[model samples]
Target: MKNQFFAAALIGLTAAFGAHTANAQEPQRFETEAHAIEVTTFASGLESPWGLAFLPDGAMLVTERPGRVRLVSPDGTLSEPLEGAPQTESFGQGGMLDIALDPDFADNSRVFITYAHVEGDVAGTAVWRATLQRDGTPRLVDGTQIFRMNKLSGRAQHFGSRIVFAPDKTLWFTIGDRGQGERAQDATDHAGSVLRIDRDGNAPADNPFIGTPADDLIWSIGHRNPQGAAFNPWREELWTVAHGARGGDEINIPKAGLNYGWPVISYGRHYSGGKIGEGTEKPGMEQPIYYWDPSIAPSGMEFYTGDAFPQWQGNVFVGALKFQLLVRLTLDGDKIVSEERMLEDLGERIRAVKQGPDGHLYLLTDDPDGRVLKVSPAS
Candidate 1:
C-alpha cells in the first residue's frame, strides 16, 4: 500500500513538474560588495514583536510574541495593545507569528494571522483571518480557522508559521516539521510543507496533486522548519529559508510536488551528533540555491524592489534570529554571489523584514524587549 501511494504521488509530481518547467529558470546572483549600511533604533521598550503589516493610512500593525497586537503610528509612537488578539501559547518559539492584510484590505479591512494555540497542555499551530476594526480594536467578526497542524505532540520547536500572498491572490503558508522529522515524509500530515490555498481556504482545482484522493492543500513537502517566505517580484517564484538540524540552513525555490529531502538527505547532522540521511547528493531531491554551513537561524525574508537603495533593487533581505543580524543576498542571475550582514551592532534577533508602503525597509526585533525598526539610507 505504501508503494502504491508513493507511485501515485510521483506521477502527480511529474506532471506538475512538467507544467512548471517553462516557468523555471536560474535567478541572478550578484556579488556582495561592501557598502555603508547604517542602522537606527526606531522604537524602544517593545515586547517581542514578531509580525508586521502596513495599513492604508500609513500606520502599521505589529504583533507581539506575548500575545498582543499594536498599531504603530508613522511618527514612531506605539498604540496600546489592540484588544481581542487570540490567545496564544507563547512558549518557546510559539506565539503570535506572521500577519498579512488581505489583498483587498483597503476595501474589506480583512486581516490574517498565525499563532500557536494550547489546549490541555498540548500546543499546536493554527491560522486565522478576520477584520481589524477602526476604534483601535480587532473586531474578529469573521474569524476562520483556516489551517492547523496534524499532530499535537506538545513540542515547542519548529512551528514554522509564515504567510505570503502571491500576485495571483493565492495564499502560500509554511508549516514546520514540529521536531518530528519522520512526519515530514508522511502524506497525511501538514508538517514540514508549503501549502497553497485560496482566500476561502479551499484548495485550487489545478493544484499538482489535487483530485488524487488526497488533501490538495500541500504544494511541496520535505521541509524542516521554514520561517521566512516571500515571492520574488522579478520572476514571481516563491522562495523560502528554513532552519536545518546543525548546519545546512537553506534558501530554496520550491517546485510543485518536489521532495526537498529533509532528514532523508541533509548537509546537517543529528542534534545528538549522529549522521543524517544518505548525505547531500541524491537523485530525486531538490537542493538549495544558497545554504549556510555554520547555520544563521533565518526567520523572515523579503525581496527588495524599492527605490530607497537603487543598487539593492533586486537584492534579497533575510532576518537572522540566532545570528542577530540581517543577511543581504545579492543575486547574479541564478547564483548567490555574496551575502552582506547588516545591523550587527544592534545585538537583537530580527524576526521579520518587510517593504513599507513608501518603499523603505522595515524590521521587527524578536526580543522580549523587542522594537520595530526602520532601515533606510543614512542621510
Candidate 2:
C-alpha cells in the first residue's frame, strides 16, 4: 500500500510538470493534394541536427547542435565527426547551426557555417568559411572566421542564423535581436540585421550604408530573430522568416537598407501579454509579405523548383518548430496566395528544410535522438 501511494504521487508530479516534457512522438504519414508522398527515415542517431547541405557528389554535410559536423553518404552511412570545426558555445539555443556550400564548390571546395561562440563572458553568432578536403581523411582546411556579431550578449537565445548566396555572388546572413529589442533600432550595431559581405568577408563597395553611422556590412535592419533565409532565383529577391515574442511570426523580403520594424511595430505581444513597441505599423518600416498570429516559430526555408513535385514548383516550404509541422506557402509572384500545413502527424519539431539533389524534400527533426527524413512520391 505504501509503495502504491508513492507511485501515484510521482505520477502526479510528472503530470504537473508537463510543460517541461519533450515532444518525442513518432513520425506518421499524411496525404497531400497534388501527390501522395511517403516520408522515410533517411538517417538516425543525430544529436539535435540543425542544418543540412548537399555536396556536388550527392554526399551530405549535417550540423549537430552540440558542436559536431558529420558527413552522410548517398547510401545513408554517417561518417565520423569531421575535424577542424570551431569550438562553439553550445547551450540553450546556441550551438552549431546552419551550413551552406559555396556556389563554386565544383571548382573550389569552400563551405560556410554559422554557430554561436563565446569570448570571455560574452557570446554571439559567427560565420566561418573553410575548404573541405576529402582526400584520405575528410577535414576542413584553411578555416577562416568570416563574420562575427558586433554586440556580444550574455543571453543564449535568438541567434538568428541562416546563410544564402545572392545572385551577385555575395553572401547574406542574419543576426537576431539577442533578446534585446532596442538594439534592433540601432544602426551602429550588427545585431537584429541582415548583413551582406563578399566571399572573403569584405564589405561590398556598393553597400547602402557606407558613409552612415550604420555598419557597412548591414544590408537591412529591424529584425527580431530571423532564422530562415533563401533567395528566389526567378524573382531574384531575398526572403526571410522571423520569430516574434508571443504571437506574430513574419515573412519579409529584405530589400537594400530597409527597416523591418520588430519591437517598434510588432504584430506580436510580449509573452506576458503586454503590447510591444508602437503596435504594429510605422511609416518608414517595411511590412511582412505574410504573418502568423499565433506564432508558428519558423526556422529553415527554401523555394521549391525541383522536378519531383511538379505541382509544388515555385512554392515556398518552411519548417515549423512550435507547431511541429511543415508549412507550404503557395506564391503568386510576391504575394502568398495560400498556406497548407503538412507533416503534422510526424509530431516532431521540424528544424530545417532542404530540397535534395534527387529532387525530394528532406527535413531535420530537432531532438536529442533526431533524424533526417526524406519525402518522396508514394510508391
Candidate 3:
C-alpha cells in the first residue's frame, strides 16, 4: 500500500510539471476556412533555417542558410550543429539549402545535401552525399560531392536547389538561372533545368537527353528559379514553383524533354516594368498550369496527405515570403480551384513546409531566430 501511494505521488508530480510547461508555451490559435488550428513552436534558436527533414526516430534535420545543420528532437531540444556538413557560401541566394535522406536510410544511414559553393571566381549549386553518423556523436562521414553545376558564372543569385527522390530510386534536383535569363534556354548549360541522376551522380540511362547535345542529366529546361519542388505521391509526377520577373510566379509540372519557357516567354513582365520575352505564350514552349500575378515569392511546398486535418487532404500548401503567409490551394486534379491565405498575423517569413510523420503540418520560419512551428487541429 505504501509503494502504490509513492508511485501515484510520482505520477502526479510528472503530470503537474508537464502541464506547467505546456501552459508556459501556450499555443497560438487561428481559425481557417476548413478547421480551427493551433500553432506552437516546436524548435527554436536556429539561424535563417532553410531546410527541414524528418528522421525515422522522430528527430528533425534542419539546415540553416548560414552553413550549419542541426538535429532537433521531438521535445524541442536541438543538437549542436552536426559536424561535416559540406562547405557552403552564404552569398546572395546561396548557402546550404536543401537536404534529403537516402531511400534506404534505415539500413545505410546515407544522406544528401544541396549547397551553394564557389569554384574559381564563379559560384553555383552543388550536391554532397555522405554517411550520417549518429552513434552518440552526430556527424557526417565519407562526405563527397555527387554533382555540381558545370555552367557557373560570376552572378550570385538564383541557386535553385531542391532535392526530391523519385519512386524508382533516382534523384531529381533543380538549378536556377543565376540571375542570367539566357542560360535557361541554353541546352548545353545545366542552369535553369531539372536534372535526374543516380545517387552516385551518374546520369540515368533513361534520361531524355542521352545522345543529344544537351547535358545527359537534363530532364527539363527553361525554368527561371524553381525553389519549391516535390514528388506528388498521388499523381506520381514532379511539380515545381518558380519565381518570375515581376508578376508571373508559376507552377509547372516539369516533364522529361520539355522546355518551360523562361526568357523566351512569360506571363510576367520585367522588374523595370518592361515586357518580358515574346509575351505570355509561345508555340513550342509550355505554359504554367497555375500562376500568381505580382509574385508571392514561394519557397517551399508540400502536398498534404495526412489525417491530422482530414479537411486538408488533397490540398497543396506553399510558403510565401513576399506576403509572410501560408498559401493553400485546393485542387481538382492538378487544376487549382481556389486559394486560401492564412497566418497573415504571424508576421514571419515562412521558408519551408513539411508534413510531419505525426500527421501534423510543420513550418520553418526564415529568420535569425528561426522557429519550427507545428500546426495542429485545435479541436
lDDT of 1: 0.77
Off by over 4 Å in 1: 1-35, 136-140
Expressed as tens digits, the lDDT of each residue in 63-136 for candidate 2 is: 98878888887766677778888778466678899999998989999999999877765689999899899998
lDDT of 3 by residue, 157-256 (tens): 8898789999998999989999999999988899999999999999999999999988999999999998899888899999999888898998999989
TM-score of each: 0.88, 0.92, 0.93
Provide the overall lDDT of each model, using Cα atoms, as 2-decimal numbers.
Answer: 0.77, 0.86, 0.86
- Tens-digit lDDT track of model 1 for 1-379: 1233223212111111000011222322222254444455555556777888899878888887667677777766666666567777456677788888899998988888888866665667777877788763434556677777666766667888789999998999898888888877765677888888888888887666786654588888889999999998888889999998778898989888888988798888877878898999688889999898778889999999888778888899999988998898999876789888877767878899998887778888876666667676654
Residue 98 error, candidate 1, Å? 0.6
Preferred candidate (TM-score higher): 2 or 3: 3
Ranking by TM-score: 3, 2, 1
Residue 249 error, candidate 3, Å: 0.7
Relative to the unseen true structure, what is the Cα RMSD of model 3? 11.3
How many collisions per candidate?
13, 0, 0
Cα deviation of 318, candidate 2, in Å: 0.4
